[model samples]
Target: MQLQAYTFADTTEIKDLVTRTFSDSEGVDEGKLIGNLAFELLTETPEKDVFCFIAKENNAIIGCIIFSRLIFVRDIQVFILAPVAIATEFQRQGIGQKLIRFGLQTLKLNGIELALTYGDPNYYCKVGFQPISEQHIPAPLKLTYPHGWLAQSLTNNPIPKINEKPKCVRALAKPEYW
Candidate 1:
């Protein structure tokens, strides 16, 4: 298996991977929603605000992850991880976790200070994510599952408290996604 940054040529495969994975795991509607979300995040978001990574096996995309900038009133550098997916057949093989680790490491190397994600805490915890309250760092939108709000400091320092609410990229600004 190989993990690397995604290129424009990988767009269709990435969207299909996410759509099919979510369809098999969640359902058809959810698959379409997240698949469309992934497509927009990859194609519409500004290059400086988006990062995409993929895991491939035998030259086929098997897993993918995306991180987009979260702008705050303050100057701190932060990004949000969302819409991660692993091919149905590849689930439970640690490919998702490996991709996440690689993505986070890449962010850290680029001097990103914090990483946030909203998802299953149990699964995210495996990758060093911890529950964080809006009081410490307010989310761009009201969270549907507050318990799933997670964050980690890439610099090894504690997650800092920021009173200002952050705004996510246009691709992730939909309240339905929160």
Candidate 2:
């Protein structure tokens, strides 16, 4: 399988992938949120921090992963990996895993650190993510999970110790809260 950056032509296929992934995990209607976020990443006004990658087999999209730039402390820049999706029939084929590993390697090669994500630690850990608490950094989500909400450093530097409450680091939230 060839992993490459997503193209405009991949829009519908990627949306379908997200819809299926979400439906399998959550429910049907709630699954649409992934597509909505994908739309925001592809078509919305904010363009600086969003990027996506797709896996192709025989020129057909089989999986996708997205990275959105986020802020932790005042000026710190980090990337958030979200909405990783593989076609239902293609699940457990290692396509999604490869997409994440390749995407992270690409981001690290570009000089990024502190990739954050809300996903199962088991899967993300296989790709190098450690629980946020085990590292010096902390999630800005102020949320908890049973092995969800993880972070990984791209470099050898220690992640900043975050004792202060985490504020939402991405997306719109209460102005004073995040």
Candidate 3:
């Protein structure tokens, strides 16, 4: 399988993969929520520094991951990776891992200093993520694991001190509701 920047043609396959994967997981029964999440990633503003990667095999998308800018008080460049998913049949094939590594490399080349993800620490730690703590970076929310609020700095720069929730201009919901 090859991991590449996602394209329009891969949208449907990505959607199908997400649906198949989430159907078995509890509390994720909302189809429109799934669709909106994908839209939020795909339509991310370049000025906001959001990008994505898709895993493909036999010309079909099997997995997807997203990285988006998280604006803090200091203009620090931090990215949040969310909703990494693999097609049910392709689980355990490392497609999701590949997508993440690829995206990380892509972001690092562009001088991004940090990457954050709301995912399993066990899974993400393999790629260098650790729990966000008061000593390093403050929690994005008061929330904690198995919710997977993890962070890793890709550079030597210290994680910025965040006194409050980062301002989020985009709603994760649909445009009509905004």
Candidate 4:
């Protein structure tokens, strides 16, 4: 498999890959829910505020990751990764971590200072993410599973404390998502 940025032409395939992957792992309803979320993230979010990467094998999508820009009171550059999906058959093969590392490296090159994600601490930690508290960097909304909030500094500096809450793109602004 190879990693690359996703293009508009890959829309339907990307959505299907995400939906099927999620459905296989989570449940049918969750698959549809996240599938719709993926579509909105691609179609509704401002072009400058979001980025997507994919893993393809023999020209077919098998994994995908989406990063949306986050706004904070400080002038720091930050992004939040959400709704990652790899083909159910591809799980535990390091594709997700590889995709995430690639995305982080690309973002760092473009001057992004921090990357945040809400997910399993054990899985994320393997990719340099560490559990972070709202006291250090507040999220855009209330986190139902606070322990899942995580972050890692792209730069050499440590994750800094922010006094203000961050703002996420409209597609991810809903309470249910957080």
Q: Which predicted model would earn the best lDDT?
A: 1
Candidate 4: tens digits of C-alpha lDDT, residues 27-52: 99989988888888999998888889
Supply the global lDDT for candidate 4. Answer: 0.92
Best by TM-score: 1
Show the lowest summed lDDT stretch of 10 residues, model 1. 71-80
Relative to the true structure, how large is the alpha-carbon lDDT of every model? 0.95, 0.72, 0.70, 0.92
TM-score of each: 0.98, 0.82, 0.81, 0.97
Q: lDDT per residue, candidate 3, 1-178, as tens digits?
A: 8889887666667766766666655335654566557665666556446777888889878888877777777757788886677877898877777788899988988889888876678899888787775445554444435346678888876555566555333633233321
Candidate 1 structure quality by residue, lDDT tens digits, 58-172: 9999999999999987888899999999998988998899999999999999999999999999999999999999898899999999999999999968999999988899989
- The residue pairs found clashing in candidate 4 are none
How many clashes in each structure?
A: 0, 0, 0, 0
What is the full ranking by lDDT, best candidate first? 1, 4, 2, 3
Give the poorly placed runs of model 3, Cα more than 4 Å off: 27-32, 44-47, 134-136, 139-147, 158-160, 173-178
Cα lDDT tens digits for candidate 2, 1-178: 8999887778788887788777887788767877666655665525567668998888888888988776554556578887788877888878778899999988888778768787788898898887766245555555446357678788787665654434432442323211
Worst 10 residues of 2 by lDDT: 169-178
